[model samples]
Target: MRARAGGIAALVLGAVIWSAAPVSAAPAEGVQRTTIGAAERATALRFWTDARLRSARDLDAPPAASTPPAASAAGGRQAAPGTGEEVRVAPLPAPGAAAAAPALAASDPTPWTGGGLISTTAGKVFFQNAGGGTFACSATVANADNKSLVLTAGHCVVDAGTGEVYRNWVFIPGYANGDRPHGTFTASSLFHLDQYVATAGNANYDLAFARLAPLDGRSLGDTVGAQGIAFNAATGREVHSFGYGGSAAEGNGERLNHCSGVEYPDAGREGSTMWGIDCVQTGGSSGGAFLADFDAGSGGGYLVGDISVSAGSSEYHPVLGNEALDLYRQAGAA
Candidate 1:
């Protein structure tokens, strides 16, 4: 299936991007949820043995030539008709706010060699589509009930055209080439925005959350810990984006890559209000985390967004808004 809304795709500029249809005032507009059965969970676990892990294709590439073109490369829910282009302001979490300087303060994209909470919290997600092809995207653990929530991009969890949830879904936190430091956690169910699943290319609803089944009888949070998530967060602030995307410049996706920058209102397309950053991460990096006020030592921070779309060779966009926060609330309850 073709990618809808947000994800890693080669950016095509100067096109007349269409705006998203107006969404309802209801809190849960475009949200869809489903649970994975025991049998399916068992099958997914067995499917990702060492051999398959070595062979899974990186999902960072744009859709194949035969696939249909996506409606908009803009990633995020369409802003209301007359909202200004300025980045909206929101407050940061209170307790964790500290006086010490940030552990990672650089604005440049850097190779994450190792160490820190992010090492265990962020990892690569693997799934198989109806076409029988194995693919990958980035994902991270989030605090939730059952202590097994895995947050990622909607495009990674659901096929837009068929509305079929991707199968064989498993997350390998801190996954390095051939390394599964935290062991594999399979999903028991997945949740996404209804607008994303119903429409062909709605970036505003491009994110997703999954409730994972325990591996070796231990909950996911207990194993690697979970990151704090936020919605309707303050914009135009410094953010640290982490991913396992293929690096054309570096020539590998085996190691974690991160870029730090302040998010700004994207003005490239009309009818849509998306957040963008200046970073060069490419494919296979889709669904990676866009964290705010990240504490490198703690590996915990507010999950403001995830990798959604390419703005150019060096810039990326992630979705974070009211609808996205509502999706998280619904998923946590599920």
Candidate 2:
């Protein structure tokens, strides 16, 4: 898997749900964490001023290299997309809808208006890369007992090449054209699957959870509300994916962009079972949220996945499984 924006490649692996058994060898290794001290948080806030954000709007990069339309591997010989394997009834009911989603004119897929929770829950993530330069990605606020959890792609938090997690992480919900309507929320810590930290190439575990620090004495959920997250969720859904990434169709990551499509299994690898959508979201959209039965009002829905990697401009995300559940539970507890 690779981020088209950065042109970075990572090793991807077949999907396998790891059990919740303790790793006795490393008792507390299931979830990896890194703290952002006060000094760093203060620096991050000033680093993302209005001017810097506006400059980023024009910085969307090129799409990642494209994969062969089809390739050979092992397990199911790449099931043809839309074989109904991607469509399944959600294991549990999705969150209640507040207002209907934006309506398209049938013939048009353009014109993506930031709607519902999509407006407040989904936002741009900024971090300092290992190179000391700034980069952006998409992310979403997720419901948690602590009211401080955020969901995003693993690579957005950790740089696979240097094996170092990026620093100065901050989330700005409803961010548009360098505007922070809800102000900025810096990350207290970041966590991801041990598998991703170890393999660095396994797209199967590319999702991550971030714990945000309180700003103005309020948790992230207290301000924007959070979306219900489902693990071991049913597949084959008609999903609406959101991101703030550079795209010719999307005003180059200045405004949020999204597309609706059915999820399908990976066509290039055997047993890789990663979920994919037919979208053209570019770099900054890497960590955006994928919502099932999204609502325009309330901004609440079942968070099934996030933008992880791209096959050309099309996007792929790790499906929520047992491993994801464990990560969520541990991150929320923290």
For model 1 the local lDDT of residue 39 reads 81
Tens digit of per-residue lDDT, candidate 1, span 1-334: 1133245443221222223211222235567776767787788888998888767766653332211134344443434312223233222222232232335544445776545667777898888776667777888777765667777877787766556667788999888876997788888778887766555545555678888887888888778777777656677888888888665543356777778878887666454455767775666677888888677555567787777666443344445666666676776666
Model 1 has an lDDT value of: 0.66
lDDT of every predicted structure (CA atoms): 0.66, 0.66
Cα lDDT tens digits for candidate 2, 202-260: 66677888889898998888787777787767778777787876666666676777777
Measured with C-alpha atoms, the lDDT of residue 232 in candidate 2 is 69
Over 4 Å off, model 1 = 1-29, 61-108, 248-251
- Report the lDDT of model 2 for residue 190: 84
- Model 2 spans with C-alpha error above 4 angstroms: 1-27, 56-111, 296-299
Error of 1 at 152 (Å): 0.8
